[model samples]
Target: MAVAIRLRQEGSKGRLFYRVVAADQRFKRDGRFIEILGTYDPQKKGENTNIDIEKVNSWISKGAQPSETVRSLIKRQVKAQASN
Candidate 1:
């Protein structure tokens, strides 16, 4: 199966929190997942993203493809880390 690094919606209806996960491409957005790599809280003032870059990179190195939004988040994470 082609694994995809993606997001799963959680929290309340109006206020959504997201879990960044690795899952099968055929699975539903909020369905079963292989791993919970991290979280994204857009409501936070700063550093609203919390991810384990090592884990993300590890998964990618193993042939996991990240979704468009997840790829963007990963890029931001990489940039943030580089700036630190």
Candidate 2:
């Protein structure tokens, strides 16, 4: 099975929260996830949306794929790191 790291939507309408998860590629967007690596809360302040960076890196290292949106987030993360 192709493993993927991606987001699952949460919260009420007009307000949104998401969890970053690892799951089978064939699963639906919000379907069962193998693991919850971290979360993304846009409502939170900088760095408060604590992601398990080590876990994410570990999954990536293990050859888990990331969806397009997750890939964009990864790109942004890289840019942020570069600017630091």
Candidate 3:
């Protein structure tokens, strides 16, 4: 099964919240997921998201592809972590 790491949109409208998850590509965007890697709160700036880098890397190694937005989020998180 092709796996994809992507965002699962939640929360009420006008206030967007997201969960970073690993799921089968065939599954609907917010339908089902294998695991919850972390969360993203766009309304907040830096330090607004929390992701398990190890888990993400593991999934990637296992052939899970992350969506564009999730990729950017991962990059941003890495950059922020490096500064600490």
Candidate 4:
């Protein structure tokens, strides 16, 4: 099955949160997922994304394609890591 790394929505209407996940591309955006790689909190101040780059790299090496938004999130995480 084709796999994709994407976001799964959670929390209430006004306070939305997301989980970075690896799942079958055929499934619904918030449906079955293979793993929970990390979390993203837009409401948080400063560094708002908390994703495991190691796990993300593993998924990428395994041919799991991340959506454009996820790709940008990964980049942001990487940059943050480097600055620390």
- Per-residue lDDT tens digits for candidate 3, residues 1-84, read 999999999999899899999999999989999999999998997589899999999999999999999999999889989999
Candidate 4's C-alpha runs over 4 A off are none
Clashing pairs in 3: none
Estimated TM-score per prediction? 0.93, 0.76, 0.94, 0.97
Q: Model 1, 1-84: lDDT tens per residue? A: 999999999999779999999999999999999999999988887888988999999999999999899899888988999999
Which portions of model 2 show Cα errors greater than 4 Å? 74-84
Clash pairs, model 4 backbone: none
Better of 1 and 4 by TM-score: 4
In candidate 3, what residue range of length 10 has the lowest lDDT sum? Answer: 42-51
Model 4: per-residue Cα lDDT over 11-70, one tens digit each: 999999999999999999899999999999889998889999999999999999999999
Residue 23, model 4: Cα distance from true site in angstroms: 0.5
Model 3 TM-score, all chains together: 0.94
Report how far residue 64 has shifted in candidate 4, in Å. 0.5
